[model samples]
Target: MKNLDKLLEKYAKLCVKVGINIKEGQPLVINAPIEGLEFVRLLSKNAYELGASEVYVNWSDEVLTKLKYKNSPMEVFENYPKWKADSLEDFAKRGAGFISISSDDPELLKEMDPKKVAAANKSASIALKEYRKYTMNDINPWLVISIATRSWAKKVFPKLEEEKALKSLWDAIFKATRIDQEDPIKAWEDHMGNLKEKVDFLNNKKIKSLHYTSKNGTDLKVELPIDHIWAGGGSITSSGVPFAPNMPTEEVYTMPDKYGVDGVIYSTKPLNYGGNLIDEFKLYFEKGKVVDFSASVGEEVLKDLFAIDEGAKHLGEVALVPFDSPISNSNIIFMNTLFDENASCHFAFGKAYPTNIKGGEDMTDEELEAHHVNNSLTHVDFMVGDSTTSIVATTLDGKTLQIFKDGNWAF
Candidate 1:
């Protein structure tokens, strides 16, 4: 009917065609916030046209969860719905592909305890991992993409009405995913190629240690092992070929040395947790392990997170993101690390990256611990990126090389 409507329709077609690779006679699963119901309906029509046998949608809302936070007992935080686990298991068993749209209310969980939030996150991931092992073995396809919902869209542009805000977010999402490109699939191919170059650079450098510094929080240095692989470009096909993870992703990450990190760092953005958000989060690290943490708004939650297990305090991801990203250039404060960390470099605590370690699963706990690859169900990423953030590499020969300055690549 209109240019915008045509674009929206094309975007939906692209998602189903390229993003999900919809197949005939296959069942489709969609998980989105209520604001996405309209788009989900549109997708359902396209899915059915492409021979989808069934299209199931799970519409979510923060209001119900808000009600729980306002009324449920504190102990309810530790519990999870059994049906959710069962459903995911069944989906995996049925060889169904999943497409989850993420547009979380960044501040909704600001008041919740970090520990409870971490526990809940860990529980879901553990169940998903269990299901994934079976699904991945069979090469059952799945895809996840974050769409801007009204609640989150409003947070991004406070001045705009909810509908306009949602539209603005949609614009950004489409642009970031290269949906505007004349050839979107080709754009991804080139983008992934650039990431491969970065990964190759890190591998060739053979950096033994990474050093970081910034105002208000960081003076951290971590020793990396030789086995650690700098991973990006989503990952590989079950057959061990490369593929994209998220459409807009541009990051090169590695698993950090479990016992080789030392410093105190402040999170650049607030973290959404449980049903609350934590801000002004500061953490102290000793030998690649989080020894203590504090957040100005949700200190209680932070404490609970550290209590999950001994390995919960360990670091999982260490990623590098250039400051010149289109998102960072907007100078918008997202308050959501999932989006913000991509604006600059960041790290995470908890579960190690399986791909980073060689034969990690077969290794004994003692052997794994020796390499600083501890096992934990919790892996939460936080943004430590900042305007003055700088990173340098030190070779085993004591040669120093500049890696990043003001969030840009120095190499």
Candidate 2:
């Protein structure tokens, strides 16, 4: 086997330098499954080298999580540890940059009760609402990335030997993240520049609404807020530092008016939420709220997700990604949102980000609500873009423009 350590170190450095853009004297916080300890250690080392003053790691274990779900009472699922939420709030208050690593077994909680999973997720979100606001508003830098783990690798390559599967998964991750490039940082710089150009074009058009259609029974219209900001590739922090929120991101996204969406859409890929896989799902919307939904698998989990809160039924984010992107071309399901969401166009339900609008960062909760930005304790992304999908945008000046055709950029 080749020396994987060097590649891992390089990947860590890229994340520290480009993902969160850790600054001098800044604190860094990491949340990851304990299986990612090796990469976490490398990341911590890289953060310190980048002049981070302190680094805090919140380690999690899938086995422990499984045990809790199996043995804990139902009430326990309705409460999140206050100390953990407070720690996140403290980090946000101190302007700490965050890097979250996902490397857990995709089906670890597959057998657990969907209601309990939803309850726990909702409780945690409610507990960390303030922290979520900070990150969502770009008050603090935050990044989400995935690492290859034994269980996750097995899920992706069930036919392969354990060691071979891990290697294949690692290779795919590296390529998707551009870590395989000769100069990964430089590659990211150029990639981000191209995405920014797209964002600028969209912003210049001042799109009023987007019309989506596909052969797969998807026909939806999404209204954009007047001050909607199309963000992609990388985002600037309150301090003017740039950071990439998702390592291999290829989408330009903005929040939609919570009450301005209407139509029906079908999922193009499976959504693995809370360790359960919801596949072949279709959602019907009326006035921007989910009126009905069904899934071929994990239907109960889908129902539990919508019951999280009122905002959970409304569209919070609408993101556009070409079908021929590197991740999509790889033809890997991934079963992970960080990768799948970027592979195709997607929408997030619940908890719209305040930073998605102009002057939104400073807006009060009521003010944001007045703009029709949904607020809730959950945000989940599901893919709906495929080769048959097409989209048109209506500009504020009443000009109609084709944005996507055959799942790629149109004009």
Error of 1 at 223 (Å): 1.7
Deviating ranges (above 4 Å) for candidate 1: 13-28, 42-56, 71-77, 93-96, 109-129, 132-142, 361-370, 396-398
lDDT of 2 at 280: 97
CA lDDT, every model vs. true structure: 0.72, 0.92
**How many pairs of residues in model 1 come into backbone collision?**
13
Q: Model 2 misses residue 288 by how many Å?
A: 0.5
1-411 in candidate 2: lDDT tens per residue?
A: 456887898799999999998988999999999988888999999999989999999999888999999999989989899999999999899989999997778788998877789889889888988788889888899999999999999999999999999999999999999999889999999999999999999999999999999999999999999989998999999889899999989999999998999999999998989888899999999999999998999899888888889999998899999999999999999999999999999999898888899998888989999998898889999999999889999999999999999999997
* Global fold similarity of model 1 (TM-score): 0.86
Residues 362-398 of candidate 1 have per-residue lDDT tens digits of 5665777777775675666778877788898997678
Candidate 2's C-alpha runs over 4 A off are: none
